[model samples]
Target: MNTRGQFLSSRLVNDSLISLFVVSTFPPFRISFQLRMWDWFQQYCPWVLQGISMVYGMIVRIRRKAYQREWLRPKHLSRPVVSVGNITVGGTGKTPFVIWLAHQLHAKGQRVAILSRGYGRQDPSKNLMVSDGKGHVKEWRVSGDEPTMIAQHCPWALVAVGPDRFRLGQWVLEQTPCDCFILDDGYQHLSLYRDLDLLLFDATDVKGLCGVLPAGRLREPLDSAKGAAAFIFTRSETLSSIQPVQTCIEKVIGQSINPIVLKMVPKQVRHLVTGEVQPLTFFSQRSLLVVSGIGNPRSFCDILTGCGLEVGEEIRFPDHCAYGQDEANLILEKIGQSDQDIVVTTEKDAVKLREWFSKDDPVWFVTTDLEFLAGEEHILGLLDRAGVV
Candidate 1:
C-alpha cells in the first residue's frame, strides 16, 4: 500500500481499538453504534505506514556493498570499541548501562571515550564533544541530555557526537590517547567496524516483531540478537520469575553469547524541589506527581508506584522532549495547589528542566540506572575477550 493508505490504516487500527476499549468501559456513552464505521475504516485502510522506512532499510541493505567499500577504516586506537545498542526502537537502557560500563572501566585505570549520534539533538550539522575540561575534551555536542549526563558523572571521560562515527572515533584517537571507545546507542551503525556488539532487549516488545522495519518496533529481526557478543535484558525489575525468563532468553542467545540481566531498581528518591536525597521509603507517605520524558513512561510510573508512592498524577512526554517554560509553569501551578505533593521526574528530564526551568522551581529530578546483578562476570568476560579490560 501507499504511504498515505498505510498511515490511515495504522490510525484506523489505533482509533478503533481505543474506541472499543473506551466504549466497553462506558456503555452509556452510546458510541457503540459508531463501531460499524470504525470497522469499515480499518478494513479499507489496511496497510503499513512504515513503508518508506522499510524501503529505506531495504535500499541500504541492497547498497551495503557500496557503503562498506569506503567504511571508516580507523587505525587501531589504543582502546577497544565496545558498542551498546538495541535492535528495537527505545527503552533499552543504553545510557545507564554505558555509564555503569564506563565506571567499571575507569576503575581499572583505562582511559575511555564515548561516541554517540546524540538522538533528538536540535543541531545535527556539526560534530560536538562533551567533557569536564580535562584530558578527555573532544569535539562532540554537550547539548544532548545523555552526553551532558555522561560528562557530569564521568567528568574525566571524553564524549563526542557526530553523524560520522568513524570520523569521530578517529578524532578521539588523535586528541586523546584513549585506551577504549564505547559506542552509545549504536546498534545499527555498521559503517564503523565494532570489536564487540552489545544488544539490549526490552522484554515487553520482544514477542511480536518482524525482521525488518515498519512492520514492528524492531530495527532488525529477532535474529539480530545473534550479532551481539552479549545480550542485556533491560526493565528486569518487571519480571516476576526473573530466573526462568533469563534462562529462556539465554537459550535464545545460544552457547556462543552471554546473557546479562540488568535491573533499574529505585536506589533513592530525591525531593524534586529541595534536591535532598532521601531513601525510597520516603515515597510511602508522599502524594506523588510523577513526571518523566523518557523512552519508557510506563516503566517509570511502575517503579514509582512499586516503591509505594501514591501516584496521584503522571505526566509523560516524548523522549528527550524539550519542555517550554509555560508548560513547566502549568505543572508548578498544579503542584502549588496540591497539599505538599512531591513532583517527581527522571534524570534525563531533569537535565532539560535545569537548563530550561527556573532555578527556584519546586520540580525535582530523580535519577535511576541499570544495575547488572548476577551477570557482571559474563559481561566482564566478554570485555576481556575484546581485550578492553
Candidate 2:
C-alpha cells in the first residue's frame, strides 16, 4: 500500500478499535459478538496484538523523544509542579489520591491549585473554574466529577479544569496565583515539566510480565516509570502483597527504592441528601443494590463485601457515565423490585446521580480515604523536598 493508503487504513483500524472499546465498556452490550471477537483476538491471535503494540510503543517513544530532544519545549513555571499519574489507562484511585495530597499540602500551609483535563465533562476542552479558592463548583457537568469531588472535599484549595494545562496554568495565575500546583493524571502530559513525578500503580502480581494495550493495562511499558522520582503502589491489602511488585519495580529501575504503599480505606457511607452518616457496616444486614459508573467496579464491590454489606445486585455503567433519566428510572425500578433495601455507589457516580435523584433518594455513596500502609513519612518527605511546605 502507498503511504497515504497505509495511513488511512491504520486510521480506520484505530477508529474501529476505539468503537469496539466503547461498546465493550458498557455491561449490557459488552457481551456482544464484538467483544467476543476481541476476546478471541487476545486468546488466539497474539501476534496481531504484538504487532500493534510494537507500533504503539514506537509512537510513544518518538513522542517522548521529541520532548526529550527539545524538539518540543515543555512549559515550566516558577511554582513547584507535583504530578500524580499512572501508566495504565483506567483509574488507579488517582482522584482520591490527588484529594489526599491536596489535604496534606493544605495542612502544611501551602496554597495548592489542582489542574486536570476534566475528563468526561460536558465542555472540558475549555478552561473553567472547578473551585474558586473555596470549595464551590459552578456545574458538576462543566468541571467533571473528579475535579468537582476535589472541590467539594477541599474547600481551601483551588481546582481548575482545561485540556490544555499550559493555557489553564496561565489563566489560573491571572485569576489567583498559587504556591504549588498538583497536576492530576499528568504522566503522559509531556507538554508540562513537573518537579516531582509520583507514578501510581495498582497492586498486581509480579510474576506476570507487564503487558500493553489489548494484552494488558499498561499504557506505557514498565521501563517508562524508571524516570519517576518515586513509585506509589495503591490498593495493597497486605504488606506482603507489595513486596513482589516492589521487587519488580526495583528490577526494572535497576535500584532498590522504597515505594509508598497506600490503602484505600472506607471513610463513611453518607446519605445522598439527608446529611446522615453511617458506618460502612451499617448496611451489614440490609441487602444492598450496588451501582457504579467507575473505572474499577470490582474494587468497590470488594470494599462493600469487606465491610460486611449483603450486596445483592450490581449495575455497572461505563466510567464517568452521565446518568440520564432512563438510567435513573432503571435504578429506581431496581431499588423497588430487588431484595435490597437501599442503593450504594461511588462518590463519582453520586455527583451525576444528584442531577437525576432528589434529596430524599435512598442512594448513598461510600467515601474512601487513602492512608499509608507503612511509610507516611515518605509522602511528607517528598513534599518537604519539593518545597510544598
Candidate 3:
C-alpha cells in the first residue's frame, strides 16, 4: 500500500476498541467525528473490512501453521531466548521492559543480548547487527526508534536486528558468550521457542473492541492471551483503576491466567534543552501543549490531564510518524497562534523529534518509564522461578 493508504488502513484497523486488547495501547490518532464513525462502522461495514483483512491474516496464520508443522524449525542457539512482545501491533513499552529486564539480569551477573526487526531502517539488509562503538563493527541497522533507544539506554548488553531473530540469536551467541537472548517484539515469530513470553495489554482502550482481526485491532483473537506465559497490563495508572481492569481482562481471556498487572506512571518531566529532570508536579501548575505521534496519543493526553496539567491543545499523528520540515513549520505556526505556553511529548516521540526537531526549538519532551507496581516483585519471583535471573 502507498503511505496514505497504509495510514488510513492502519487507522481503521487500529482505531477499534478490540485493538486495545491486542496491542498494549490505543491508536493515538483521533478522527474528527470518531464517535459517529464508530457507531456507523461498528453497525454496518465491520464485517466487510474485517473479512478483507482476515484474508491477509489467514495467510499469516497458515504461515504460522507451516512453522507449527515442523517445516520451519528455528535453530536453537547456545543460550535461552526470552521474548518480550505482544500479539497485537503497536507500543507495549517493550523497549522499557527489555531495559528493565536486562538490568535485573545484569545485577545477577548474567550477560544478555537483544534482537529486533529494526522497522523503518534506511538500510536494506536481511541479516544485520548493531554496532558496539568499539574497534569491532557489529552487523545490523541500529535505525528503528525502539532499537536505537534500546542500544543507547542499555549499552552493556549487546543489541542486534534482523528479519530472522533465530539467526540473529545464533550469530550473537557465537560473537559473545551471553547467557540469555532477549527477543524484542517477536511474539508471533514462531520459529524460535521462547523460555518466557510477556504479552502487554493497554488498560484504557479494551472496552470497544469485541472481535478479531480487521474488524478490530486484534492480530489474533483474545484467546491468544492464553498462549502467553505471562500477561503484562502496561501503562495502567491509578486513574485506570487497574484491579477492576485486570479482572475484566481475565474474564475476557477466559482462563483466569492470574497474570501480573504492571502500572507505569510518569514520575518526572525533563527539559530537553538543559537535560534537567524535574518533578512531575511542575506540570500541574503549567498550561501545556501536548504533542505526540504514537500508537496511543489519547492516553498521553489523559495522563497530562490526570496529572493536573491544563492540557490546552493536543496534536496527534499516525504511529511512527516521521515529522517533516513542513509539518514542523506548521506546528510552530500553530503554537504561535495559541496562548498555551509549555509543550510536552512522550519519550518515544522525543527520540524521533531529536533527529529533526529539538526542545531548544521551544518544545519540551516528557519522557516516562513503565514503573511496575506491587506486582513487580511477584513478576520478579516468577522470573526467578523460571531461572531468568
* Steric clash pairs (candidate 1): 79-179, 79-180, 128-139, 128-140, 128-141, 129-139, 129-140, 211-221, 272-364
Clashes of each: 9, 0, 8
Whole-model Cα lDDT per candidate? 0.65, 0.77, 0.65
Off by over 4 Å in 2: 1-34, 69-71, 204-209
Top candidate when judged by TM-score against the true structure: 2
lDDT of 1 by residue, 1-389 (tens): 11111011111323113221222212323434455544554467434434654675566554443544655343344458889998766566788888899999999888888888776577865677767338454322235778877777788888888888878888777776788899998777777678888987765443424335443455654544656777787777644435454454456556444457778877775544456787777667877776666666666766777777777765544566555665476566657766646777887777677644554665666677676655788888888888888
Give TM per candidate.
0.78, 0.88, 0.81
Find the 10 residues in a row with the least total lDDT in model 1.
1-10
Candidate order by decreasing TM-score: 2, 3, 1
Span of 10 residues, lowest total lDDT, candidate 2: 1-10
Q: Which candidate ranks first by lDDT, i.e. highest?
A: 2
Per-model C-alpha RMSD: 8.0, 7.4, 5.7
Q: Mind giving the per-residue lDDT tens digits that candidate 2 earns over 1-389? A: 11111111111322123322432133444445666777678779978887888778778877877987899999987788999998875557889889889998888889999999987899866899789986567677888888888888888888999988877888898999799999999998999988898988877434223666656556777777876877888888877778888887788868887778888889899988775899887887798888877766667777787777776777666677777776777778767766876999998888888778787888999988887887779878988987767
